[model samples]
Target: MKIPYRGVNAINSREIDKVLILSGTFGEGHQQVANAIHEATQLSLPDVESVVFDFMALGYSYLYPLSQYVYMKGIKKFPRLYGYFFQKTRKVNSFSIKLNAVLSPGMGRTLKLIQEVQPSVVVSTFPFAAGVMSKLKQYGLINIPTVTIITDYTDHSYWIHPLTDQYIVGSNMVRQALNHQGIDDSKISDTGIPIRPKFFQAHDKIELINKFGLDPDLPTILVMGGGYGIIRDGLTTFRALNALPQSIQLIIVCGHNEKLRHQVTEEFKHSKHRIYLTGYIDYIHELMAISDIMITKPGGITTSEAMAMELPMLLYNPLPGQEQDNAQFLVHAGVAMLAENLTDLKTKLLHLLFDPKLLKKMKENTRLFSKKRSTFDALDVIVQMKRQVSIPNFSVTG
Candidate 1:
C-alpha cells in the first residue's frame, strides 16, 4: 500500500493560489519547516493550497538513499571532516561558488515538477532546492518568485542563491550574516523558524500533567534525544538526571531509537525520580507545556518549539556545525544553556532547578526572544510573492 505525502492533497482547487514547497529528507528540520508552513497556510488561508514535496525523492530517486547514508555516516563517524567542509564552504567566494554549482542537482527534475505543479510561487526549505530554483530563474526557465527559508541560525554559502527573490530567516543575527555575505538586506526577512501553530497556542500545564498521568506537584524535565536518538552520551545524561538529589519527574522522549529506549528503560527502572519513557511521540507540544525545563539537542525546529512554549532549555552536546551555532545563539539570547559533557549537563540542570529566579529569567527571555508569529509571517511572504508574479510565461533565454 502506498501512503500519501503530507499536505499534498489538501486542496482540490484548480485555481492559482498555491505554494509549491520544496524540501529534503537529509534531516528532519527541513521537512518539519515545510510542514509547519503548510499547516499555517491551511489554517490561515483556506483558499490558498500548500503542496509539500521532498525534492530529493522527486528528483534523485536512486541516489537519495546513498546520499542519506553518506551524510548520516559522515556526520556520526567523521564529523570533523564534515565540519571542515562546512567551514571551508561557508563563505561565498570563487571556490565556494564552484562547490555550490557542483552540489546543485536536480535542475531538470525541479523545472519539470514546477511546470506540473504550476504554483504561484516556489518556496524552498532545503538549500539545494533553493539553488535549483535560482539556477532555473537565472536561465529564464521559470519566472515565479522564489523564497528560501533558512532552517538554521547559521549562514552558509550553500543557501545563498543569486536569483532568489527573498529570504525568510530565523534571527537578526543570521540576517546580518547574510547581509555581510553581500546578500541585499531588503531581500531578507527575520521571521524566525516556522513551527506548527500548536506550539504557539497556550497549553495548560496542570491540565497537561493530569492528562499524562504525571505528578503535578513535582517539577517536570523533558529530555529529547532527537529524531534518530542522537544526543551525545544520552545514557550518561539520563544517569546524571536520575542521580539528582531533587525528586522530580522525567519525561524521556527517545525518538525512533528502540535500542536507546530499551536501554534507558532498563537502567531507569529503579531510579529515584519518576521516569516516563516514550518513543517517537506526536504530542511534543503537550510535553513541553507540562515541563519546567527541557534538556534537548538544539535542532532548529525543536528549539523554536521550546521557545514558542516559553520553556527554558538545557542544550546538550550539539554537533559541531549548525547545531553548535544554534546553541551559541540561544545561549547568547538567554533562552538556553549549553552543556558540553555529562558533568556540564548535570551542573547546568542543577543550577536551573536550584535557582528558580534564573529559571524564571530564562523563561521570560524566551517570551521576549521567540517569534510566535513566524508561521504567519512566512505565509504572508508567500502570499506577497504569489501576488507579485506578473510574467505570464517563462522560457529559456539562451
Candidate 2:
C-alpha cells in the first residue's frame, strides 16, 4: 500500500486532489469538527477535495447503532462509570491498550477505501479512526501522512498513536499534556478546536436581534443542551432561570430533542420574560451574535464556538470527563463560569445578568483565548504534509 511521492505530486497538480477525513457519529462534536475542516478546505483550497466518512459506521455498520446507543445512554444513565473509565484510560495503560485494540477494527475495509480514494493525506477527527490509522501505519500497510485532530480541550491515551505524523489540539494545556505523554513537541500544534467559519465572522447584533424578533435592548441569554439535550436537571435549571428578576430574552435550543422542546415550551408558556424555544436549527451563529451570555454544557465544539463569538459562558453540570476538563480550562482562561448545581447556576446567572463589567471582562478574555482561525490553521498543517513520507515507529510509552 505504498504511495510514491511522485504519485502524490501528480495528484496534487491535478484540477482536484483529495483529503479523506475520518469521523464518527458518537456525538456531534467529532462530526462538526470534520465538517469544519471540510468547509475550510472548500473555502481556502478549492482544488483540494475533502471527503468525510463516518468511519465507525462504515467499519461496523451492524454494531454501530447499538454502540452509539450504549455510548449516549451510558453517559446519561451512568456518568460516574463513564467518568471512571475516562480517568482510568487518560494515560497509556494496559487497559487503554486493550481497549484501543478492541476498538480498531476493519483495517482491511479502511485500507480498501484509502486505495480507492487515493487521498494525498488522511485526517482523523474521531479517536477510533486515529487508532485504526495508527495501526495501519504501524503494520506497514499504508505510507500516507496521517494527522489526528483531537476535538477536546483534554488529553487522552486513545487520541495518541505511535505512528501519527501530526497531532492538532484545541489548547496549549492539551499540547503540554501530550508532550508529557511522550509525543514529540514538534508533532503537535495547539490550533484551537476547528469550528465553522461563520463563528469567526462578525455579525450585527441589533440586526440579528431584529431578524430573530428579539428586543435589541434586552440582555439576551442563550441556553443550549448540546445536540441530544443531555443537560442534567433540565427542569430545575429552567426553574432557576425563571426566577431571575430582570427582563431578559431567553433563547433555548433543544437540539434534535423534540420532547425536550415541548417540555420547555409547556413550562415557560406563561413566563414574564420573553422565551423562544426551538429544536435543532442551522442559524446558531446568528443566535450567538445576538446573545450576551451562553448557558450550556461545555462540549468542545460549543464552547469553542462561544469563544469565537466572544459570548461569555456559564457552563452547567458538565459530565465528569472531558467536559469537566473543558469547563476547567474555560473558567481558568476567564471566559466562562462553571455551575455544579441548580442553586449555583441560578446564583451565577443572577450575577452575570446584573454585572455588566464582569461580562465585558469575559468578552475581552475571549480574544486572548480563542483561536478564531482554527480551521484555516489546521488546513495549513494538513496542506504542508502533502510531501510527508512514512514515519518510522517509535515508543509511545514514557
Candidate 3:
C-alpha cells in the first residue's frame, strides 16, 4: 500500500487515474505550465483526471495576496533589488537554506492535501511546491514519484531537491546548468517548457486579419505586456512607434488594465497610423498569426508561444532577472532582439521593420528552435514513468 523512499514501488498503471499538479501564481508562467500539463493529460490520457492546486493559496492562505502584491511591486519599482536577491540566491547558500526552513510552516497543509487527494503521481510547476514535496518524501510521509517542470530557461538552486525523481527542462542549456549543480544526467529531460495545445494549432492568416479588421497590406506589430499590461513607459513606446517613417499598423493588447487601455486609446485616437487597442482577450494566438513582429517583454510562456507560432520577437525592456536571461538566450539564438531603452527600442524596431530578410531569418530560426509538441512530450514522460514502477528501486531517467 505504501511506497519506499529510495526505491521504486510496484504501482499498477491503471491505478494512476489521478494526477495532482502543484502550481503557484507568483507569475503567469508557473500557472500556465500547470494548465498546459493538465490539458495535455486530459487529451493524451483521457482516463487520467488531472487537478491543479494553487500551492500558495492552499499553504499561505492569509499571506498569499500580500506576498503577490509585494512581489509585483518589488519587481516593478525596484527591479535591481529584486534582481540582486534573485542572483544572490541562484546557488544554495545559508540564507536560502534558512529561508526554505522558515517556509516549512506551510508543508503540513500541503501534506494534508496530498493525503486527501491520494494522487498516483505528483507534478510540480512551482519551485516552492517541489521543495515541499521533497521534504515530504524525506520525512517518509509520502513516496509518490515527483516530477518538477522548470518553467524558465535557466535553473536556480531553489528548484533542486534530493527527492525529485525527474526534471523536465526548457532547453539543454538548463539541463547542463543542473548537471553542473551535481544533478545526474539520467534524471533530467530536455523537453521544452510545456505550452497549451491551442498554441500549436495553425491559423489562417488572411481569415484572422479579416476577422480582427486588421490591414492585410501593412505589416502588423503585435504589442503585449503580460497579463497585467505592465509595459514600462507604454505611452512613450506608442509615441515612438507612431513617429516611425514606415507606415504600419499596431495591435496592442492591454490585458486586464482598464486604465492602460483607456490611456492608449485616448492618446492615439487621432494618429495617422492605424492602431487598434483592446483589453484582455483570449485570441492571442490568432493575433500572433496575423502579425509580422511582436513587441513585448520576454516572459517564458509568451516567448515560447510566439516561437511556436514562428513569430519573431522584439524584446523591449525586460525585467532584470529571469526575463533578462530569457531575452539573452532568445537574442543569441537569433530568434529575437532586445531593446534596452526607448531610443534603442525605436531604432531596433525601425531597422527590423525595414529588413524583411532579417525578419524571415528570425522566423526560420524560431521554427527550427520551437518544440510545439512539448506538452505532449512531457505527458509521455510522465506516463512512461508511471508504467516503469516495476522494481523496488527504479530511476525515471532516460
Candidate 4:
C-alpha cells in the first residue's frame, strides 16, 4: 500500500496520526521522555492524534519484569558491569544485529502498525528501537521518517545506527560521543530531549500554592527520589528540615511505588510539620512550580525539567552509569549538589535552607544551563528530514 503525504491519508489518517512511541518502564526517564514528546506533539498540533505505547509489554510478559530488574538492580549493585555490557556490544556482529532486528518489539510491531495507521513518520525515544529501525530502513520495509531521541547523556552501542535519519542528543558531549562512533555530524542534532513546553514558562509559587491548596506562608521542600522510590532516608530528610523552627511543608511524589508511598505517608502522619505524600501525579510541573528546593535523583528528564523551572536540585546518591554522568554534569555546572548518602543528604538540605545566598546562586546557574527552545528545534530538524525524504514520492503525486 502506497502511503501518500497529503489528501485523504494526511487528513483522515490524521485521526490516527499515531506516532508509535516505543519505551519501557525500566527507568522513569525513557517513559518521561516519551510522554513529554507525546504531550508536546498533541498540544502543539491538536488535530494530530498521538498514542504512546510500551514496547516491552507487547511481548513476553515474564521477560518484562526481568528486564526492569536487571536494569535497576544492576545499576545499584554493579553499575560498571552493566555499562560494560552495552559498551562492549554497541558494535556487535551482523548476526546479533539481525537477531535484534527480528526480536525488537518496536521493530516487529512497527511494520504491521504502519499498514494500519499509515503513519507519515515514526519517532522513537528508546534505544532498543534504534537497531530495528535501522534494519527496516535498510530493507525498505517502509520509508517513513525514523528518528531516535537519546534520553541520556552518555552514548552506548544501543543508540548507534547508520540507518538513523536523525539522532537527537542531550548535550554536545553526546553528539561528540556519537561522532566518535563514526556517525556523520550532519545526522546528529544537539536538540535536547523534548520537554513539555509548559516548563518553559515562569512558575508562580503563590499561584501554584493556591491551585494545590497549599499553605502560602509555609516554605516547601519537595522530596522525589525517583519514579520508583529509592530506600533513601526520607524520614531523616524531613526531620532535618523540620528542625528549622519555621513552618515547612513537604511533598513527596512516589511514582508507581505504592509501598514506599505508604511508608512515607505513615511517617509524615506522625510528624509535627505539614507533609503531603502522593503515589502518582499527572501535574508534576505544578508541584515543581511550588517547590522551593527539590531533593531528588538526577535523572535526565528530572534534571531537564528542574532546569526548565529554574529549581535548585539537591541530588541524593543516584545510581551509577548514565544517572551518575547526569549528576556530574549538573554539579560541574553549579546547578546542583550531590549528597553522599542519608547523612549527607540531611546536612546538604540544612545548608541550603540556612544559606539564602547559595540558593539564589544555584537558581541563576540553572537558568544559564536551561534550553527553552529545544522542542521546536528538534521538531524542525526531523520534520525537515521527513520532508526531504518524502519529497520524491510526493513529486510523483503532484
Index of the highest-TM-score prediction: 1
Worst 10 residues of 2 by lDDT: 1-10
**Residue by residue across 1-398, what tens digits does model 1's lDDT show?**
01135433344445757788998878678988998988888788998878889887866778889988787667867767777888888987888888777767788877766666678889999998999998898788888999999999999889998999999999999999999999999999999999888898887877888888999889899999677767777577788888989899999998877888999998998988888889987789999999999998889989999999999999988888898899999999999999888888888888998999999999999999899899999889888888887653445556
lDDT tens per residue, model 2, 1-97: 0111122223333246788899987888998898899888889897778878888887887998999989988998898998999999999999999
- Candidate 3 residue 308 Cα shift, in angstroms, is 0.3
- Best-first order by TM-score: 1, 2, 3, 4
CA lDDT, every model vs. true structure = 0.86, 0.86, 0.83, 0.71
lDDT of 4 by residue, 1-398 (tens): 01112222333354434455566567777777777766676666665554555656544346778777776666656756755654456565665466455557555455554555555666777776666667677776766677888887777667777788888888888898888888899889998767777788777778778877788877678878677765345456555655655567888888777877776676667677777778766678889888879988788888898888889989886665577778888898888999997667767877888888999999999888778887777766655665655421111111
Residue-wise C-alpha lDDT for candidate 3, range 17-39, written one tens digit per residue: 66778888787788888888888
Kindly give the stretch of ten consecutive residues in candidate 4 with the minimal lDDT sum.
Answer: 1-10
Predicted structure 4, TM vs. truth: 0.83
Model 4, residue pairs in steric clash: 90-157
Report the lDDT of model 4 for residue 182. Answer: 88
Give the C-alpha lDDT of model 3.
Answer: 0.83
Better of 1 and 4 by lDDT: 1
Whole-model alpha-carbon lDDT for candidate 1: 0.86
Name the runs in model 3 displaced over 4 angstroms: 1-16, 103-105, 388-398
Each candidate's number of clashing pairs is 0, 0, 2, 1
Following a full C-alpha superposition, what root-mean-square deviation does model 1 have from the true structure?
2.4
